[model samples]
Target: MRPAMLIRLALLALLVAFIVTPETFAPVFQPFTKNGAPAIYTQTSLLSLTLSHLAIVAVATVAATLFSVGLAIIVTRPFGVEFLPLSRSIANIGQTFPPVAVLALAVPMFGFGPIPTLIALFLYGLLPIFENALTGLTNLPGNVSEAARGVGMTGRQRLTQVEFPLALPVILAGVRLSVVISLATATIGSTVAAKTLGEVIIAGLLSNNTAFVLQGGLVVGVLALLIHDAFVMFERSIARRTGRLY
Candidate 1:
């Protein structure tokens, strides 16, 4: 609705158009190639690569969200309170290790392709979601919680109806961070034979073709920016609906 958001949407549209029909702008990339060695990557369709890349990120992020949010909820419960440290440790393992390392470690068991990449991304995206969920679940206003208890609400009822609704915006903030991180990191999935935009960049790097690299990087960077902005808008809407924002 705002001018800035409209501008970003327009730019994203142009980038998506470029990815879909790169040959239309071959002349622009001509300078980046040598001896007319194809200014665009043609080994695989960039649109297909982009779609596959998104699919991988979507799947991984969903898995990470479920696991991390579940674990956070558990640790916030009375019976599971003592295991908070252990849960944090488990979530930290994902952030502590590099995605590449996770891929290398997973490849031996999962073999090449999207499986390893999914494992890497799923692990890499856990910490932010877990941390945010934990913070949201634990930091409720005391009086609001008391009101929930006073209303003949059981612990489960309070959690499902009162606590979680209040905590959703914060939890979604964590998910936004994880999704953006996973978007960038998912590029590395190409190294393990996964179909992604990284294939374009990797091909460029291998053949010393900057044009290919630029195409891949531009798409991924713009996609990340657009997704980040969308998440911000969604979070603000949620905050307003929850009366966290005036």
Candidate 2:
């Protein structure tokens, strides 16, 4: 009903149409190509490339979330507090190291494919989620935590029932950032023979086909926007349920 929601739905529909029946829109891209060059990327189905691209990002983001959140939980515990700096350094490794370098290093051991890409993405996505989780877990209202303890809740029970739930919106915010970054970065995985939307962009670059480049970039940009919006909606929903939303 809202204009923003309507626009998002329209974008989603157009993205699906582009992926499922790209050739039908070739005429729209005709002006961007040479007089006789193909106006759309046809070597691989856009739908397949999109799906593969999402799969890689999803897998990497999930892996990063689990590791980062778990590490955050550990470091927040009394016994694990001393390890906080070490944990921060470990999470920072991904951001400090170049993704291309990670890919190059991983290729020999993992071989050219999604595996190397997954390694690069997984490492790259860690810092945001880790930092957010740490912030959320550490910044809880003192009274709420005291109340949980006053109710005779064990540390583990309080964490599982109260702390984690309250912190979820913040954690989700980090996950959203990680996912968006991974979506764009995963395109680089194509250099190592990974199946991704980057294939279209790379082919276009090699052939000097603006149409191909535009199609690839447009699809990736739209996907990132849609995913970002989806995360925002989910984060807001969680915040509302947790009484964190105004």
Candidate 3:
């Protein structure tokens, strides 16, 4: 009965419509199609494209999360503190170069398809997660660490038990940002022969099929919103459990 519940239901219904009966929504796109053209984007299944898009983003996000969080942890440690600036510079390099450029440069070595796209997405998604992980690890309350040390906890134990739990919410915030950004950016992968919603948009552009463009754009937009909302909910849950408020 809550607004949140209703919104979730609505999103679920919309996703089902897109997956199960995309044609049911085709009529709305009729104005975009040419006089003699089909009003629907029929070259590929929207569901399949959506799944592939999410899979690419998921893999890239996972890779970014591991590398960024690991680097952040390493640079924050006593042994590796000196490398903080270098790590930061490396992470920033990805953001400095646009994802499109990364793809362009990567394609030469990686060849066309998802590999180049994966590399671009992985590089592009690193900064926020890295920064957030660094902040979370470095900003722990002094007393907490002292208490952890006083309890005869080893450095590893303190890190795993006392520090990480408190830092998880902040880290999740970064991941949320990374994921949403990756979702939007993943569409560009189609330019390099990767299968994505962007393929539909590109086809529409080349053939002058407005319906295809609209359909692809709408699907991608809806997916981004859906995934973002899911992350928002997850971040909130983490914050609440961690005794933090976003």
Per-model root-mean-square deviation over C-alphas:
1.2, 0.7, 1.3
- Once superposed on the true structure, which residue ranges of model 3 sit more than 4 Å away at CA? none
In terms of TM-score, how similar is model 3 to the real structure? 0.96
lDDT of 3 by residue, 1-246 (tens): 989879877977887697667889877888888867887777888888888998999999999999999999899889999999999998897799999999989999989999998998899989999999999999888988899999899988988997888888889889889988888899899999998888888889989999888878887777777777888888788778877767
- Compute the lDDT for candidate 1: 0.91
Question: Ranking by TM-score, best first?
Answer: 2, 1, 3
Best candidate (score: TM-score)? 2
Candidate 1 positional error at 2, Å: 1.6
In terms of TM-score, which candidate is stronger, 1 or 2? 2
Clashing pairs in 2: none
Task: State candidate 1's TM-score.
Answer: 0.97
Candidate 1: tens digits of C-alpha lDDT, residues 135-219: 8899888999999988899999999998998888899999999989998999999999999999999999999999999989988
User: Residue 62 of model 2: what lDDT?
Assistant: 97
> After superposition, which runs of candidate 1 have C-alpha atoms over 4 Å from their true positions?
none
How far off is residue 200 in model 2, in Å? 0.5
Question: For residue 177, what is the lDDT in candidate 1?
Answer: 95
